[model samples]
Target: MSKNEKYSHESYLEYQGKYKGIWGWLFSTDHKRIGLLYLYSIAFFFVVAAILGLLIRIELIAPGPTIMDAQTYNGLFTVHGIIMIFIVVIPGLGAVFGNFFLPIMIGAKDVAFPRLNLLSWYIFILGAILAVASQFAGGGAPDTGWTFYVPYSSTSSTNVIFALTAAFILGFSSILTGINFIVTIHRLRAPGMGWFKMPLFPWSLYATAWIQVLATPIVGITLLMVIAERVLQIGFFDPALGGDPLLFQHLFWIYSHPAVYIMILPAMGVVTEIFPTFSQKPVFGYGAIVISSIAIAAVGYFVWGHHMFTTGISYWSRWFFSFLTFIVAIPSAIKVFNWISTMYGGSIDLKTPLLYAISFIFLFMIGGFTGLTLGALATNVHLHDTSFVVAHFHYIIFGGMGFAFFAGIHYWYPKMYGRMYNIKLANIAWGVLFTGFNVLYFPLFIIGIQGMPRRYFDYLEQFHTGHFISTIGAIILIIGIFMMLFNLIYYRHRGAVAPSNPWKGVTLEWQIESPPTHENFEEIPEIKTPPYLFKKES
Candidate 1:
């Protein structure tokens, strides 16, 4: 096929194909377009979930009901957790950025299963629709929380079945995406690009994909069992019938725990890419970083029992899980040290992306330290169901993974859209988000230690002040988020045209045109040097 002249002069945003307008994007098999599909869809759900989170905060701002009743508050938070965990964070980086750049980084035209790539997205959307639809169509919205724990989940009159079904479908979508990535990485690396020569982002995705493939089915089957128990009354989780509730926790966390790595690994991959580019050095300990990614995925599976310590498990099991949890942190700390070492003597750019990456380290450290507290037997007994657990989780997921995602978006914004956002505004947004995030969740940590329980619609008078402060922080954080989103949207159309290699990134994707062509390269480029080589531009 002859290359169109427009492929050189125009971005993918302007390139026309067999179908015109919406239909073109909706049905197109291009990995980049499919990635954007995930981006836009995920962004929509993120906003919805964010709003729900804000409402939850507002309701907790005062001791008494501020916006909704107890039942409504419970339902809202349940939906919020479901949407955020399943729809946003778990698939956040891999589905969006990974799908967009993995093939290009590896010098392939697209993912090995291009059609299946599109199918995975469709399934994700369908699952999201079912989850939301349950709120309006069923007996009521689910009140079992995102975990959908037993007895309560089994007995809830609300839409537990619909929520379970939604989770099940989403798991299928995740598994397909994982399979596509694994096959693409194994089969499609450019000539001479050996296993060690591949970029860190793809390596992280490789590790995450394996976890997704191996671990997600456990949750899929577990959720299916929940649905069966609810419908068929088979009594798997309900003690009144014949099954053990603790068994449900065991099965659930088996997948859910590894699912944590699925959410954070790609985010770490994003940070890995950004550090070397902005710092203008090869990532410190490249082999260590790669091994750490694989190690985290492997060790993550064995630590699920830490989440179940509050339940009555064998004494040895609790200590065993706690030990495994601490062991997982060693590799995590190694990655952190390597990142810091990479920036030690380098000419750092201090761009918005790096700012977010730095912030991720700080926030993730706090989350990690607090996680150790929970991993201990005595501390887990005190903090397991308190707002402390909630605070630590947000610090890791929102503060860690969420910051890394923002870093990826800013670092790749120019490449993805062929334009640059206002740098000053981007930095300002980052500052606000960073400060507001700490203020919001830090107060929760204080109150949680003061004995505030989680998931309570109302709080004790002693905790009211902390709740009030957190609510204000939530508003500020939302403002910063909106500002950042607005800046990106506004600049996509009007911002200055970007250079192909805006970040001076050495990855294969940076060698191609910005917003790369439908067929990424005219001919697959031969790889010679390692991926992280930082050459001084003449």
Candidate 2:
């Protein structure tokens, strides 16, 4: 195609394709459009889930059915976990940012399966609809928690079947997206970009996609098993009904554990892309980072058993899992050290993205260390069902992945929208969000150590102080969240027009027009150096 035809003056947002208006986006095969679709949908689900979580917190503030009854609270948390885990965090980054950038970063026009990409979003929507509908579909929300632990899930009188169907369907969507990314990375990388020559974001997604494809089937089967047991009177999880509970745990966690990586790996990729760009330095230990990404994925698969340490697992099994758990920690630590070293002597820019990246390291360290604590057999026994697990989880998911999501959005907002959000406001919102995040979860670690169990709507008088403080923090967090989101939303059209390469990023996306053309590249660019060559840019 000629340069003018290939690099249209109109952006993807403006390109009038075979369809017009909303239909243009609905049936569109464009990867960017699909990414935005996922973005909008995920954002809505996130708000719903977050509000559910906040209501749960409100109920816990005074310890005695403050705002909601026990059954209502159980239903709230159950739906909250299902929405946050399945709809929000699981597909948050990879589906939104991954769909948007993976092909562009790899120097391709779109995914290996553009049609399938659009279909994945459709599946995602259908599954999300089912998940939410479980709340009001005449039976009330499923109270099995997001994990849907077997006996309770299989026999629960609530809407367990609807939730199970939703989870199963969502897993299918995840598998398809993963397959699409894997094939795209393997086949469509720009000419001259070898395996080692590819950027870290795609590498991260490459590993994540493998985990998604290889591991998701386990959960899909497990969810199906639960649904079958519920509807067909089969015995799969309930011990009284000829099923083993521990077996259920194993099967559920096998996928759920790797699913953690699916949630966080791309976050890692987003920051990996950010560190070098903000520091104006080539990524430190590129080969090490690359290997660690793959290593984490490979090692992540075997560590699922750690989640089952407390379930009367054999002595040898506990030790084996504990050892592998620590083994998995190695690569993550390498990434941390590599990230810090990348900034050690480099000209670091404390922009919005970097601020979030730096905060991620701090929070992830807390979460990672706490995770290792949970991995220990003795501590696992102590904290497995305690509030500490809740604290540690939020730190990792909200603090690590959520902040990284914000950072990626701030970093790429210019390129994605062709406009610049107010930087001062962005910085202010980041500070508020970070502070609110800590205040919200840090107290749980203390209260958990003090013996407060998770999923409880009420607590003893001794734990009352911590819960109260955490509630206040939740309110603050909501404020900060609204502020950050408002800044981005309001600026979509009113913000200053952004330059093509605002951050002066060395990647090919930076070399292209803002809000990249319908086809990402005008002509496929040949890569001849490391992806983050700051010296060349300087």
Candidate 3:
């Protein structure tokens, strides 16, 4: 516990148990431990989902239902999408980074409601287990896709009811975490840390929290209605019972669409933090970036129709959603521009975090531009369910959000663990990931454009070349991910001794001892400027 002594990982757990026990890990309210728990759980889900991804990619290598039957393929993509979106991305926002760093970043003792934060995590785990258990209960996981669109969902042979119910449970966890973060940020700022003075990372969390609180409930009720139709046969979305299937699309996208923003906004926030610090300059458009984040969250709600453009939505609604979709990209573009501007004529440090951040901008740009093409109703008719859409999204989510998550992880790994990862290995891992990710995802773009649909185990011979190339990419990509994990996990104890500020960035976390203490700070420090305002010591 002393500042000079190395923090024992076992010691932290021992202190936690002496004070609380199994109940401590289960019922305690330490944000760092909670964050660590999230870190562990989400990474577990990520691996499972990633394996499913590899399976899907492998099946398509030669085409024609190589692995599982069509029905099983349906289940694979369904569970893959469900676990990745609801279990992995949603909980990750508040549970992992927010839990561990939000208080540390803003100089608070804990979140405004620590117990509620703990409760949120349990609810999330419970919901994840319930969703997984559905695979065994009735029909072995729902095949109605992650969205669980109505008529198919209502009449599907799979355990649609159980799956929808689990999703509803996760929604509550998302809402509570969002609410906890909002209240904490609003009420818990340290002295002299005005709103503008707070770090961009917390500001991004603040924006993301609003999206969670306001948008998540819609999905909660929407899923409940889906369950109602399946169980009680109330028929809100069942056309046979005086309901409209398209209405299901509307209500579903109402939540599902903004849900994507919830995943990416906090990521954008993390990138915002990294760009300035590594560039060693003030954020080029601080006020503009903050406003755009809020704008993206606000405007993100109206564009759900874009996802349903191929579902026979009215032309006017399609046009409106298209316009809104294009408008949404403006804010995101501003962020990218601002990041590049921050690097303009500045001291840009080519460290691991900076490498990931720059990669995020590149991948995000491709995703955003391609999304515009899909948003256009005319172009979307061809690409609606194709690999183009798949490629665009992976680039955005995997390349954009996943990379940002790694960037944050690498940027803070030393501070989080009180140890340094092998810099050579770290760079090598990043190189592998960056190379393999593009190899894995980029060819799907070509395959999709040549008329290959996503989730199809059978494809025409014309797409074979692209599919073959994509498989090679997947192998390399997995290697990259494994290397990154090995260094973080196996190298934790044996890595070089990390100083308090290995990156030499100006954040409150760097001001404290590595791995932090039981309370995060012995004495919470006061900040007079943004966390990334790099100033050389005199």
Candidate 4:
């Protein structure tokens, strides 16, 4: 049989199309295909943002301007932050893996609304275009930072309107995706599959989706208010017109703070899945992990004030937010301990995915602990707007979420593409990336304590040594990233075909055919027990 004929009988990949070539993919409503669509687009923007980050590091290597002037540097900063936060990390795991695997894992044919899922991707792209277009079409690139703090955001000559519009639209896309996931999980589980029996990945998504649906609207409304301030001279955020800038900060953090959980929760879910599968054992404290996810989401909302401790808020409010912030960390710590306990006596497989998972725990621990310093009013007063804050943010987002993303890609790459990446190359790439990552960000902790403010194009001579070392780390990190990307691309065609259950996972997804059939299952699977139940073969 021809490839098309063979796929026609089995997987979505082989489905014949009315529109040949690119058009088919563009219009595809297949959850797997839509997931790949997100993967490709997100990867492209990730590279763009990474390159911009490297440029910033290179310029900072010395005390003076090395590559571009200050204005150009500021533009790059705004664009980089916008792309990484809104485009890459926020939707990273859910849009790619969740869309592809959630239905299969739950024994459903597809998402509750496949068309809306696809529409979300298009809206994301449109938001990205408007954000980038602002740099070229309007007065100049937006320089108010990703937060778009006012009265600077309102009074700035650059295309603040475009930036605001892009963020507003992107919020809509996020909200829609959240709605889709919530409905799917609630309504689509297989026969005998109860809420507790569901896999950790979907459980994580369940928590994340709630945050996305609830918290995103606050930021959306805030961004719209910003546009109003710019275009209609609304006195909402602009102090010049009887508006309170502090109010903008409050509204923005109310969303953005919970938004951090939106980025990391799915990643935690990814780790949860990888642990039991690679260890060849059941997850440790599955209930605790699930409950912690809900706790993080619930408590995440009340801690936004921690970000504004230095904004002259009430002393009681400051301490209250700090208490909530510390409280949120308890559930996260519970998860870490459980993961380690899961691997204690099990048959641990040191695969690439497992390696990335281990790294995530290490890096995320650092990110979490450092965040406590920022939560405290005394330390935050010293570290506010400093490079220490920048380092902490990246550790959580890049070190934590970014590594988990790598873990998920490697863990599920075979299932997604029916091919294996070279294990040796993957290990080598992880070593270099891990080493470079620490060298790149660790020194910022020292310099930040010494009072080096972030977002400056130039720095005092005392900070030059740290910047130089960090710059070198960036170079090394980039090299590792390129090598990893090259291996994935090259092996896509040349690697050996992967088996249906390469890691010997017990999830419903592992029970299906690799790259799964168009409708996922000929008949829906009936769950006999909770997920991650391992069986020995004769």
List residue ranges in candidate 1 displaced over 4 A.
1-8, 536-538
Q: After superposition, how far is residue 486 of candidate 3 from its true place, in Å?
A: 0.7
Per-residue lDDT of candidate 4, residues 1-538 (tens digit)? 1222221235677676676678788888888998999999999989988999999999999999899999989988998999899989998998898899989989999999988998999999999888878777768888988989999999989888998899999898899999999999999999999999999999999999999999999999999998888888889989898899999999999999999999999999999999999999899999999999999999998999998998999999998999999999999999999999989898999999999999999999999999999998899999999999999999999998999999999999888877788999999999999989999999999899999999999999999999999999999999989988998888776777777899999999888777788788999989879897888521
TM-scores for the candidates: 0.98, 0.98, 0.96, 0.97
Where does the lowest 10-residue lDDT sum fall in candidate 1?
Answer: 1-10
- On a 0 to 100 scale, what is the lDDT of residue 478 in model 1? 96
Q: Considering lDDT, which of the candidate structures 1 and 4 is the better prediction for this target?
A: 1
Against the unseen true structure, what C-alpha lDDT does each candidate score?
0.92, 0.91, 0.84, 0.91
C-alpha RMSD for every candidate: 2.8, 3.0, 2.4, 2.2
- Model 4 lDDT at residue 467: 95
| lDDT minimum window of 10 residues, candidate 3 | 9-18
Comparing candidate 2 with candidate 3, which one achieves the higher TM-score? 2
- Positional deviation of 469 in candidate 4, in angstroms? 0.6
**Candidate 3: what lDDT?**
0.84
Question: lDDT (0-100) at residue 508 of candidate 1?
Answer: 89
